[model samples]
Target: MAAYTVPKAFPTTVVGSYPKLPSAQEALRRQRKGEISEDEFKRLVREAIRGVIEDYIWAGVDILSDGEQSREDMVVYFAERLRGYAPGEWVRIFDNVYFRKPIIVGRVEWVSPMALDDWEYARSVSGGRPVKVILTGPYTMLEWSFDLHYGDRREAILDLARAIRREVDEYLARGAKYVQIDEPALSTRPWREEAELAGEALEVIFRGVSAKRIVHICFGRIERILPYILDYPVDQFDLEFKNSNFRLLPYLKEYGYDKELGYGVIDVHSLQVESVEEVKKAIDYLMKLDIIGPEKIYIDPDCGLKRLPRRIAREKLRNMVEAAKLARKEWAGEE
Candidate 1:
C-alpha cells in the first residue's frame, strides 16, 4: 500500500481536463496563428489555469489539477514536446470531431520537463491546496499515434514509458504530491498482449514515485483489462463508473480488488447536471453493493469536463462535492 494518505476520505477531484476559459481559447487561436508573443501566450494560459483552479476551489474539490489549460489535446501536447513525433493528417476520434494525429518519425526522447512551467505556476497560485500534474501515459501515446519509426511496438512503447517516467520524476522533484497517468487507450484493443504491454509500460512509469500514484482508464472494455491492471503498481485506479452505470462493480467485487477507487459520481458527457441527492443515492447504492467501502472511495467525474459547457461543469462538480459531504454525514458513525 502507498504511504500517501488522503486529506479527507471520499475526496472530490476531476479526471484531469476541465473546460478552458473563453479568453484562453481565443489566446490559443492567436498563439497558433502567431498573433501573440510566446510570453504573452504563457501569461494568458496561466491566468486561464488560475480561473479554472478558482472554480475547482469554489466547487469544494479536495484535490485539484491545473485544468490542463496549457494543453491543446492530451496526446498532442506530449507529442509536440517529445523528440520523435511529427504532426500527421487529421483523424476522427468521435462521429464528427477530429484532431491531428501524431506520427513517430525518429527516436522518442523526453528532452526536458514538458509541463514544469505550467505546474510550477499553478502550484504557486493554488493557495496551499495540493496540485496534481496529469500526463498522457506511454501506452496511450503509442496506441493513439502513427509510428513510422521504431518498427517494434514494444520498443516504441517502452521508450515512451521512459519519457513518462522522467516527467513523473520531474514533478516529484518539484514538490508535486499527486500525479495521474492517463492511459485511456488500454481498453481500445482488448488483446492480452496489448494489456500486458501496457502493464509493462505502467511498471516502468510507476516505479519509485512515492506520491499518490494514480492510473485513469475510461470508456472501454474495462473488464478485459481488469485482471491485468489489478496488479499494476499504482496506488489508485481512477475509472469511469457513472458512464457505465457501475457495470464493472461485480468484477471488482468478485476479484476482491483492494485499492483506492476513484468513483465517478458525475457524468461529464451529459448536459444535465447531477443533483446532490441523486449523487448521494448513487453512493448509497455502491455502499449496499459491498464491493468497496467508503474508506477507499474518491469522488470524481466520469471523464474530463472539457466537453461540457462551463456552467454545467461547475454545477456538476458542486453537486459531486455536496454528495460526498452528505455521504460522509450518513456514514459518520463508522468513523
Candidate 2:
C-alpha cells in the first residue's frame, strides 16, 4: 500500500489482530493496574509482534500485520488514543461479552499517529514482507461510540474520517505499502441507510492517500451491501466467504465487483483449525466462480483471529499458507 510489486498468485495474508501471546496479555493487564511500567508493557508487546512476524514469515504468508498485540480491542484502542473521547460504561458486544465503549465528549481529532511504531516494528521483523497497518475506520469508530458532542451523525462520521485520514496519510508518507480499515459496521443492520455515510467517510480517508487501501467488512449482512459496496473508495473489499459458506460469492460475481479481494479462506470464529484441503476448496470455489483470479485475491481468514486460542490461530495460518500454495500451483498447472 510503499513501493508496490505484483504479489504472487494467491498471496496469503491476514485480516489483522492475531491472538495475543499469554505474556503480552498479562503485561497489558498488569499495566492497567499500574503493576508494570509503560516501558515494560511496550517491550512485551514488541516481543509479541516480533514473534508474530516470525510466525507469518515461517508459515509463508506474503502479506503480514503487526498482529495488533498492543491493542486492547479494535474500537477501544483507537478511541483511547484519539483526542476528545473517554471510556464509557461497559457494554455488551456479543453474547456475555462486554467492552468499555467510548463516548465522544467533544470534537474528535487526531493528535498523533496511532499505529506507526507498531507497523514500523513489524516491518523490521517481517523479513521484508509487506506489513499492513489496520486502522478502525471512521464510520465504525463513530458508530461504536456514543455521540454526545456531535448530534449530527454525518458531522461526527466526517470529522472522525478527517482524523483517521491523517493517520493513513502518515502511514503512506512513512512508506507503508498496505493499509486496511476495519468497518464491520458497514454490513450491520440498517446497512442500506449507512452505506452513503460510509462511502463519504471512505472518501475522506482515501482522498489522496494512495497505498493498497483495503476495507474489511465481515460477519454481517454482506448481500445487502452488494453493488453499492463495489463503489467504496478502496482498492480491495475484504469479506467473509468461509463464514457464510461462500454464499456471498455469487453476489460479488453478479455485481461484477472488480477490485482486488482479500479472500476469506479460513474461518476464525471456529475453534477447529481449518484443514489445508478445506482452505483450498474455499479458494477453488472462488476461482470456479470466475469473478476474480488468484493474482487479485489475498487468501485470509474470515476476520481477525483474536477470538481463537494462540495455538489454534497459528495452526490456521499454517494451513492457510499451505492451501494458498497448493492453489497457486494448481492454477499455474504446476501440479
Candidate 3:
C-alpha cells in the first residue's frame, strides 16, 4: 500500500537457507548412534558439505553454503564446538516445542574446525562468486541459550560479541569476503524499551567485520523493531517479504536508509511453487517505490528453505533465479 524507496542496480542475486542432502543426514544419524568415530564423522561431514556446495552451484545459486544440515542445529552445534559453552537444557516457546539450550560456562572461546572447516569448504566450492560465511549472531545465541553468567543479559551479550568478533576476524582472514550474521530473534523484543539495546549490541558485534555484513531477520514480526535494525551499522538487512512482513518495505524506504536490502520474494514454507509472475508482481510493487530499485535489492525466499521438501526448495530457488533474470529483462526495457 505504501511506496518502496530503495535503489536498484544490475546483477541481482538470490540465496536461501537450504539444508544439506540425504548422505549428510544419514551420517549424522550414524554418528549419533555411536557407529562412527569422531574422525570418521568429520570426514563424512566434509564430504557432505562438498556435496551441498556442488548442488547449490549446479542449481545456479550465485551464493553457496555448507547446507548447515549436519550441524546438530546451528546454535547447538556451535555451542558444542566452542569452549566454555555447554548444552544445558531445553527451553519451550510453544506447547511441546523446545530448542536445545546451552549456557556460558566461562569466557567464550571458539574451537577450530567449526569455523575453519566452514571457511575451507566454502573455498573448495566457491568459483570466486564470494560465498557467504554464515554465523549465528551474538544476540541470537543469548536469546536461544540459558544466560547464567557473571552479569546481566547486556553484560553477557558484550562478552559474546567479543567472542563472535574473534570468529569473524578469523574467517575474514581465511578468504571469507562475505559474511551473514543471523539474528532472527532480535526483532521479537519489545522495541520501545530495547531499541538502543538491540542497536548498541549489534553495533558492538558488527564492529570491524568489513566483508559485506548482512544481518538476517525473518520468520517473525521483529518487523515492529525495524527501527533498531535500521539503526545498526551494517552493509545489508535481509528480512522476510513474502511472509507477513511484506508490508514493511515502504516504511524502510521512507526512512531514507541507504543500506542494501535482501528483498525476499519467494515463499519458503509452501509446497505450492511460486510462479515467475508472482515474483515479478512482488518486485514490481517494490520497484514502484521511490527508494527501492535494482542496485539496493537482492532476491530471496521469505525464510530459510531447510524445513521444506528438498525438491520444493530447489524448485523455488530455481524459479527465484529465473524471476531475477525476468525482472532484469523487464527493467531494462528488453521484455
Candidate 4:
C-alpha cells in the first residue's frame, strides 16, 4: 500500500491542453476544406501552440501542457515532425474520427533534437512552477501510425521509443520535470492474439524515460490492462475519472498498486464547470481506500481542455484547482 503525504500546496495538472493556439480552429477548418498545404498548416499549429501556452500560464494552472493544438492529428503530427517519416494518407479510426498516418519509410533518423517550447512558455506563465511536458508514447505512436518498413511492431515501437527518449533527454535538459506519455489507444479492445505484442511495444517505449513519468491511459478499457501498466516504472497514472470508469479505482486496490493517481474530478467533455463539492466527492471516493493517499493524488479534468471554449475551460480549471485547495485544507484539518 502507498503511504500518504499531503502536498504543502495542491499540485494540479491536465493531460495536455492550454498551449493550443487560437488558429487551431481555423487550421482545422482549412484542413477539412483542403485549402491549405501541410507545411502551412504546421506553421499555423506552431503559432496556436504559442497561444495555448500563454493562455494557460495566465489562467493560474500549477502545471501547464502544450495543448497540442497545432498538429493535424495528435499521433500523426509527431510523425510529420520527425526526419525519417513520410506523411501517409488520412485514415479513419471509426466513423468520422480521422487522422493522418506517418509511414515509416526509412530507419529512424534525428536531424535535430525534438523539443516543444511549451514548457519554457509555461515557466514564463507560472513565473516557474515546473511545466508538465506531454508526448505520445512510442507504443501508441507506432500503433497509431502506418509502419511499412518493419513487420515486428516491437522493433518499430522500440525504435520510436529510442527517438522519443532522445527527445525526453533534451526536454529534461531544458528543465522539464514532469513528462506525460499519452497512450489513449491502450484502451481499445483488440484480438487476444495482439495483447502480448502490444505489451511488448509498451515495454520498449518506456525503456529510458526518467522517473517522473505519467502514463495517460485514456480512451480505453483500463481494468483489463491495468496489470500490464502496473508493472511499468511510471510515477503517476493519469486516467479518466469524471466519466464512469470508477470501477478501476478498486482494481488499483486489487493489484496493490502504489503510484500517485491523477483523478479527473471535473468533466472537461462538457461546458459545465464542476463544483468544489463535486470535486471533494471524487477525492473522497478514492480516499476510502488506503492504497492511495490525498497528497499522492492530483486533481484534474477528465482529459484535455482543448475542445472547451476559453471561458468555460478557465472556469472549469479554476473550480478544480480551488477544490484541490479546499480538499487539502480539510484533509489536514486546517482552517
What TM-scores do the predictions have? 0.95, 0.95, 0.88, 0.83
Models ranked on lDDT: 2, 1, 3, 4
Residue lDDT tens for model 1, 165-197 = 998888888777888999999988878888889
* Candidate 1 local distance difference test against the native: 0.86
**Weakest 10 consecutive residues of candidate 4 by summed lDDT:** 1-10
Runs in model 1 deviating more than 4 A are: 1-7, 333-335
- Candidate 4: tens digits of C-alpha lDDT, residues 1-335: 23223245346777776424558778867987999997777667666766665565555566766676755566776786676689788787666856677788777654555446544544554545556777777767777777778877767776777777667777777666787777777778544444555555545545665647787877667778777667565788888877764777888889997888778776766777777788777777777776776767877777877667888887777777777777778675543
Off by over 4 Å in 2: 1-6, 333-335
lDDT of model 2 at position 126: 76
**lDDT tens per residue, model 3, 1-335:** 23222124424344434665776777788987999987777677777777666666665666656677567665787788777786777776556856678887776665664656755765675565555777787778778877666457777667776677777877778867667878777777747556566567677767776688788887766557776567677888887888773787777776786788888887776788898788788887887775665766777777677767777877777777677777777775533
Q: Rate the local accuracy (lDDT) of all candidates.
A: 0.86, 0.86, 0.70, 0.69
List clashing residue pairs in candidate 2: 1-177, 1-178, 1-211, 1-212, 2-177
lDDT of 2 by residue, 1-335 (tens): 24434356888899999888876798779877989887788888899998888888777787899999989889998998899898888999888988888999999999998878889989887767888889999888988888899999999999999999898888888888888999988888546658888988999998876688899999888899776777888899898889888899888888887899999878888998899998988888889999887778889999999888888888999999899889989985533
